[model samples]
Target: MDGLAGIVREAGRAGDRVGYFAALYRQVTVEVRTAVHGGLFDDGARMDRFDTHFGNRYFDAYDAWRRDQSGPRCWREAFGLLDDPDTIIVQHLILGVNAHINLDLAIAAARTSPGEAIHALRRDFLLINDILARVVVTMQDSVDALSPFMSLLDRVGARTDERILDFSVRQSREEAWYNAVLLAGQNEEEREATIQRLDIRAAVLARLIARPGSLVRPALELIRSTENDDVPAVINHLDNAMERSSAKQGTA
Candidate 1:
């Protein structure tokens, strides 16, 4: 988790938008680690391995993308948007979430518990959704601070926009679970094919997030127009907010 924090810090210092996701991800990892230490999971040891494997997926992809090497299509889509001026902070975040959850999460779960053992992982897997929910709420608060118009857009959109975002997360996680089951049952060759397909599907979702429908696009643009453009400051603010949120969660 410290390694992840370093990545976030470096990206923030560079004013890289990639740090947007990295900052939020580091917080989620912190929460997961805290849960592991508290013995919140059914198998703390397995979760340790699971979290490590899951994080490596993002780390490896980030490294590969930095080197201009080939990686999963989904991650490429997310990383490719780093310099895009039109995308808002939330778009960067959800793009990362789309790739990580929809593609990497399933593969990590399957690798952690192959075949029949995947069923046992289900309980712990569902538990992560709860963790994600909490972290996302905190993340939203941080983003709201940076993008004040976000709250106004939420109201003007009747919160339907927020609901749509929530629904996407829930649906993707459910699909990831089913995909993990399938991957666990497959042989090496078959698993590769399935993962390739998942990557394509996830990349498509990233595109949707980058370019939403007309109804939401105007509001998103308005929010983006009013957002703080200081990349480093935005990243640091998010990181600090998440740190405070994690501390509160730890105490609670």
Candidate 2:
């Protein structure tokens, strides 16, 4: 937790609005770092660069959005909800996941290759989905400790019988890679056009995360009542979940 994780922890301790997403992102960066160190890709250096670029988009948008500057539309919507006392922690986490994976990841992937060769990164691109999947699943449990009401989501997700909540994040990552390949094949103008369209779609998704309609919103509202306003504690839960996931991976 010395790099991104530590930075996120410090921010949370200071009640910075960006801390929750930063913690989630820290887990993702850690997973990529571990994957790179273990020689898990065709080009570790390239993966590192891609990962850095991907994470930096979120960081840059967080800064710009916080400062009321022009930024990615999805992130503008996502980060805009950070100041509301009614927004639950899980909503914040999901908003970050939606904006980062849905928008930033595609842009990063396309820029990493800048041509049809974006397809060459597919194997490792999907590997990132795996890492993100694991972190989110672990957080499903970790979040319960931070807020006792989060299990309401699990129950609601179950009753929905669609698995969309559980499935959307991974599905979004896959779509991100596909969109990246599409963007990679385009010229500058077409690429920007594609990104603008994707940004609109992603911003719509971010709104859903914040106000996800009748079936789930009531549960979320109830969950917000017992708010664990201790931002640092929530960040620690995320870090601990990452450590536990790594330990389990080591044993396995």
Give a tens-digit lDDT track for model 2, residues 1-252: 355665686776787656887887788788888999999988898898898788788768866875775698988888788788888887788888888888888999899887867878989888877888888877767777776666665655543212323328767877898899898899999988998999999888877777776777676777778767877777766767878776878999
Q: Pull out the clashing pairs in model 1.
A: none
Q: Per model, how many backbone clashes are there?
A: 0, 0
- The 10-residue segment of model 2 with minimum total lDDT is 158-167
TM-scores for all candidates: the values are 0.93, 0.89
After the best TM-score superposition of candidate 1, give how far the Cα of residue 50 lies from its true spot, in angstroms: 0.4
Candidate 1, residue 130: Cα displacement in angstroms equals 1.2
lDDT at 221, model 2: 73
Taken over the whole model, the C-alpha lDDT of each candidate is 0.86, 0.78
Q: Any runs in candidate 2 off by more than 4 Å, and if so which?
A: 1-3, 152-167, 247-252
Tens digits of lDDT, candidate 1, 1-252:
887889888988789898899988888898898999999999999999989989999999998998885699989989998999999998888889889999999999999999999999999999977887677778887887898788776657655434534337778889999999999999999999999999999988788777778777777778889999999999998887767776787999
RMSD per prediction, one decimal? 2.2, 2.7
| Leading candidate by TM-score | 1
